[model samples]
Target: MIEELQDVPAGVVGTRVSGRVTADDFRDFKPAMDRMLDAGEVRIIEVIGPDYEGFGPGGLLADVKQGFSTLTHMRAFKRTAVVTDKEWIGHTLHALAWMIPGEVALFGMDELDAAKQWAAG
Candidate 1:
């Protein structure tokens, strides 16, 4: 399941994810993202819990497609911060950080407040 991480600033959007995320997760999130984009708020910060069991195959595909399909829209973001307590996830973010056009950072859940601070700045 997923829910918006409220209390963030107007320019930033945040979410938390847990369990086996399905295409429904993407479908549910797309409109939020689209609305944010339309509103000229591009930054995003996602807190992914360790309980996240990974995405369904189709969900994974949809995520990849969205990256490409919304490449321009996605690139409008100045940064994407992924906060997690999982080491491997942090490592993955570190690995891809340079590849993504915008800055990407990973922080442990223990440092989530710091992460949000950085993302919001």
Candidate 2:
């Protein structure tokens, strides 16, 4: 499941994901993303908690479609912050940083506040 992170700045979009992610989660996620797109909020920050498993295959395909559809929005962002307590997630983000259009950063649970600060800046 994913819940919107409240109290963030106007241009920053944030969410926390947990448990076994399903296709339903992606369906729920898109509305928030579409709202941001409609508002022209280009920057984004996604925080996936420790309980996050992995995306379902269909969920993954939906994400790829979202990425392509929002390529311009993604390119407008100066940074992408992925907050996780998982070590592999950090390593994976580091490895895939180059593939992202903007700067992609990973932060541990302890550094979440810093991650938000960096992403919001």
Candidate 3:
């Protein structure tokens, strides 16, 4: 399940993902992203919470497609803060940071407040 985070800083979008993620989960969250995209450059934060059980079904594929789309217009993203305790996710973002336009940062779940602060800046 994905739920929008309302406590984030102004102009910084935030979403929290939990449970078994599916392609359908993206459906629920897509509108927020679309709005952000329409607003031009963005500061975003994504939290993969403790209840997250990883992707299921076409989730991975859906994520790749969306990620590719985002990368193609990477200039629109001023900063991206990924909040998750998962080591692999942090490593993957770290390795890909060079290829990503703007700043891509990883933060532990415990640092969500910090993530929001950074992203908002």
- My TM-score estimates for the predictions, one after another, are 0.89, 0.86, 0.88
Candidate 3 ranges with C-alpha deviation above 4 Å = none
Candidate 1 lDDT, 54-102, residue by residue in tens: 8875788877876776676755778788888888887787777776756
If the candidates were sorted by their lDDT against the true structure, best first, what order would they fall in? 3, 1, 2
Deviation of model 2 at 121, angstroms: 0.7
Query: 5-118, model 2: which lDDT tens digit per residue?
Result: 985676788888888766677888888888877775455678888789888657777777777887777646577789888888888887878878777778788887787787
lDDT of 3 at 6: 94
Query: Which candidate gets the maximum TM-score versus the true structure?
Result: 1
Better lDDT candidate (2, 3): 3
Residue range with the least summed lDDT across 10 consecutive positions in model 3:
65-74
Ranking by TM-score: 1, 3, 2
Candidate 1 has which clashing residue pairs, if any? Answer: none
Error of 1 at 121 (Å): 1.1
Model 1, TM vs. native: 0.89
- How well is each residue in 1-121 modelled by candidate 3, as lDDT tens digits? 7888999998989988899888998877788888888888888898987788889888898888778777656778899899999887788888888876778889997898899999998
Candidate 1 residue-pair clash tally: 0
State in Å the error of residue 70, model 2.
Answer: 1.3
lDDT of each: 0.79, 0.77, 0.85
Q: Show model 1 residue runs off by greater than 4 Å.
A: none
